[model samples]
Target: MTGGLEWAVTTDGQAVTLRQVAAQAGVSRQTVSNVLNAPERVDPATRLKVRAAIESLGYQPSRTARSLATRQAGLIGYCLARHPGRSLFTDPFLHALTEAIEATGRRLLVFTAPEGAEGLATYADLIAQRAVDAFILSDTVDGDPRHGWLASRGVPFASFGRTWPEQGEQPGRWVDVDGAGACAELVRGLHSAGHDRIAFLGWRDPVPVGAAKDRQRGWRDECRRLGLPEQAAYADSDSMEGAAHAAATLLDAAQPPTAIVAAGDLLAVGVISEVRRRELRPGHDIWVTGFDDSLLATSVEGGLTTVRQPAAEITATLVRLLDAGPGRSGVLLDGRIVSRSSAPLDL
Candidate 1:
């Protein structure tokens, strides 16, 4: 291996060509081109042979030339909704989804867009510049204009969350974890563990079409069905501090709950903090559970019992949906309970 595809030389110090690679692999010139442009269309055995020959000869395909031939930049776009004081890195689910995208061998181009109308212009500019082949939209809301806007522009995109019921008529591809279902499952597990007074900690703004509301509804419905006392509380934010304050209030109520299930891991951490502050033993005196098995769930002194969303699977499904383009129905995956020291594990 002479190294460096651009400066690589043959045994006699000559530049390599596609024809030479095809000949060395004992394949047709068209086969070599297909392997480079659309490997999925080529037989796996032939694809490997061509790849090995290219590596052996250090032949790098011309990116610019290939782009012109295929009209594909091989890039997937993701837009982050920038909040006033929040960083995108704080979302572990996003990190996992990004990892899954990276594994697909497509370059990911991320952009930050302010919420509301300002995002419209950003989307236009990205498309105008031909910066990406498709986009991935997460945290979808009811009547999400991004979906409509992208549809009007005929831009291929996929969402990690499903569209709201009102936006059911909209055209787009989407995949989401069944957050509401997951929460209901948590309630069932806790009920089996002999916990009757259950409290739910969630975000303050429960948009009718947002995933947070979906999860909250799940908890409420389950509590009602099980004939358990239902107490609902809201946190200003998903941070530990916000959750801690909310959890404290829930505990101070006249009839405090024996168990708390937060919508996210960060909020659950806050509940645990308050439980400790009040001299209450987590998982014993008061069981706490959280959704999204984030790093904080396991890194803490006692592991948190939470629902683990299949981020990797969601990512893969989103890519397939985007590749398949719009008109295909969205997908919803189930999340499983992850037992830890914070909650009972038998169920």
Candidate 2:
């Protein structure tokens, strides 16, 4: 146990060690370490073989061993409590992001922390434990305290949503979909279709989320520029029921909107429901569009026209930025508008 044995399989069959994994993969101990730590430096075929061997042997490296060798944990931290239901796995975008990150060979260290002081304490504990080399911050909002806390600690971190400039001297390394631009395009198309009154449905929270603000900004700006009547509605939550109430308000207004553009798919679904309840046709009597192009977008009677965020691309960019270290400009990937029966395609 004290010699330079590097690794050995235990008689209890409780764990697989590096030495046994190397033997199985036909590689040396150093090769296995390189494969685990800096896989880019390892040959493709060799890395594949080593990974296959590790999987077959059910091998999991000791955190202490890894830290002793590389002085860093081969883990990426992510927070999930900020989402609607605190279930990241249930959301397709978050799920895709998690899968893409894991596909690169790094394991995730997910933590659920309530907002404010409690969340800070949770993050501090994770850092103190050296649980991860860096973190991926998602569901960012304006004046996010997590940014200041992590930056003050000099921890390597990147955001899946863009941070405001006021949060830092420069918006930190992050990747986000161009929600504003995409929403603007959706509004422009609706306006061209002779829809004079377009309503916006979005989150009604006091603390504005960066992504949601950008989306609303795009909708408002485009409407003002086109001399269209802007009707903005907000929902206290992202659920279809909340959206339905908001959409109903817009529908029952003195001058109802001919089209609806929601900040997210759930809100858009709510608008579709209201249209259906009133026996109005979507993509004809009232055009509707939403962001994220979630599963519900296609599940509806007339598929909702929505903006499709490239989750895989966003995850890949975030990983690259995190690997390169700090001071990188934020990335904004375009979300293509998927025209469907919910929104008209003409013009």
Candidate 3:
């Protein structure tokens, strides 16, 4: 006997029921269920007894039945952005977010949806079908409509990016990395290395919004604060090809910057490529830095210096906000600069 209960072997391949577990533990069916669902409400002795009875009877609660009873689907919905030539699986942040959600005993349900009206429709459809308990949003932009749609309908949701004030006065709960702060920190590092001529290569958003804008703002603000010329800033597509062309423009200028800070790793790679093509060495001739600390950043010959987002912490905080429900204040976590040969900083 274990835990003062005899372990019983189920016969004839019949599934053990809650009633059987209650009978074995000398408790009522309600007591057994309380132990399973809300153990805090049950005393330690009774809870242990019910747990022992459950193990001995080999009882497994039906998820479908539990959902019906609790009105929770035990699923968190996430809408995958269908960006052309981009796979969501390649992003480490998504991997961390997935693992964090599963750690909470909840599964992530991902569905692809195009941006705009169709994406909103997909969210509505998921709610209509009762396919999810709540949602986790990412890639949020200024004046995003999804947050308002979810909030107005009284749905519970948390975002991985900030729901900008353009969306409304009271944006939904969110967790976002401080892109501006990360970029400003990068600038400070470069300045500490005695490089005054600094340039910024950032994504060209149709509207001045999102992370790219924030990062650019940081570079601009820091440069002005240090009295460094900020005229070297340029905006281009997030692709390597676009960044390479933009880097070429900056390099060919009359007064080129000694160091360039790209908004992302891919853009930094482009700058490095352009720098090498012109018979210039990265750390020797021109200092380079990037954000995201992605695989490409590490794969570079000298390990590109970049900003590392706190993916695990961001996801954990997102889960906490979701658990707390809507109307919770947002969280903005800082990113750390990972120093390397590209732009070594005496951290």
Candidate 4:
């Protein structure tokens, strides 16, 4: 080999190209390209020849060069809509998803979108600019306008939320957590606990149409099935402190519920705090359960019964869907029911 900063000149000192390789290997340039790309498609005899040439000439094709030759970027971009702490979604679960996306040999360009028409405008700009080859829409909504918008532009996009999968042009590219099913489970567990008076504590204002609504729907359906009245409680404030205050008020009702379900793990923590202050045991006096199964669950004095949506599974799923786009492929991982000191047998 020639020294550094110098070309590796052959005996003839002539630059080598695909034609030269093909002649030397007694094959064709197309054969070389096939071996470089869809190696399985090339005949074994041709593949061996191409490999020999590749090694002899020290030929290395960069991804960008391959894209130029094939007119494809071989890159995909995943985005999360801008909503307060855009980074939180990527903190772990989404961060895992990001890794899974990369494990499939694709690049990730994560960003957020603003709320309202401005969000759409931002999406439009990205589409116009062709900022990404594809996208993995995080924080999706029911009947998400972004889904329809992406379809209109003929850009391939997959979502972690299956909002309009049943009615979308690209009905096969969605992945989501089953919020409704998760709620149903909570109901079943509560019913098994001999709790008839079940209350659902959720956000007061409009929440995401996906899990946010599904949770309520599940709560209502379970209550109706169990012949229990639906006692819905909500907090106007968005802060954890606010949720805690709301929990206090709900617990202080004329007839406190035997069980309370919160939409978020934080809300559950808040409720547990109030439950402690009220001189009541969390897993005993009142069986409390929360979702998301965050780190806060175990740290608390009393262990909380929660549904653990592991970030690893969610991230792996996101990666699979990103790699296998334009086709229907998904797996709804089961939520873990972490039993704790609370949720005593209905004795």
Top candidate (TM-score): 3
Model 3: weakest 10-residue lDDT segment is 1-10
> lDDT (0-100) at residue 324 of candidate 4?
70
Error of 3 at 65 (Å): 0.8
lDDT of 4 by residue, 1-347 (tens): 11111223353565656666667778877776666555667778888988798678766455565456555565556556455542223366666776676555556776666754457776676666655677777676556677667766667777776664353443546666666677778878888878887788777776644566767787888889888878777766545676678877778888888788877666777778788888898877777777777676676775667777767777776666655746555456666667766554332
Per-residue lDDT for 122 in model 3? Answer: 90
**For model 1, what is the error of residue 29's alpha carbon versus the real structure, in angstroms, after optimal superposition?**
9.8
Model 3: residues with Cα > 4 Å off, grouped in runs: 1-60, 84-90, 165-170, 207-209, 233-236
Error of 1 at 261 (Å): 0.7
lDDT of 2: 0.79
Q: For model 3, what is the C-alpha lDDT against the true structure?
A: 0.80
For each candidate in turn, the TM-score is 0.81, 0.80, 0.82, 0.75
Give the distance in Å from residue 63's predicted Cα in candidate 2 to where it truly belongs: 5.8
Per-model clash counts, in order, read 0, 0, 0, 4
lDDT of 1 by residue, 172-290 (tens): 87788898899998888888888889899988874323787889889999999999888988888768898999998899999999999998888888899999999999999999998
Model 2 agreement with the true structure over 1-347: per-residue lDDT tens digits:
21333355454576677878889999998898887665767989999999999888877555577467766787889887465652222376667767766767677788889876568888888889888888888877666778667877789888877556464454457787888899898888887877889889989976346678888999999999999888988987767888889988999999999999988887788888888889999888889998877777889986989888887788888888887765757778999899999996663
lDDT of 1: 0.80
What ranking of all candidate models by lDDT puts the best one first? 3, 1, 2, 4
lDDT string, candidate 3, 133-165, tens digits: 899998777777888899889889998876565
Worst 10 residues of 2 by lDDT: 1-10
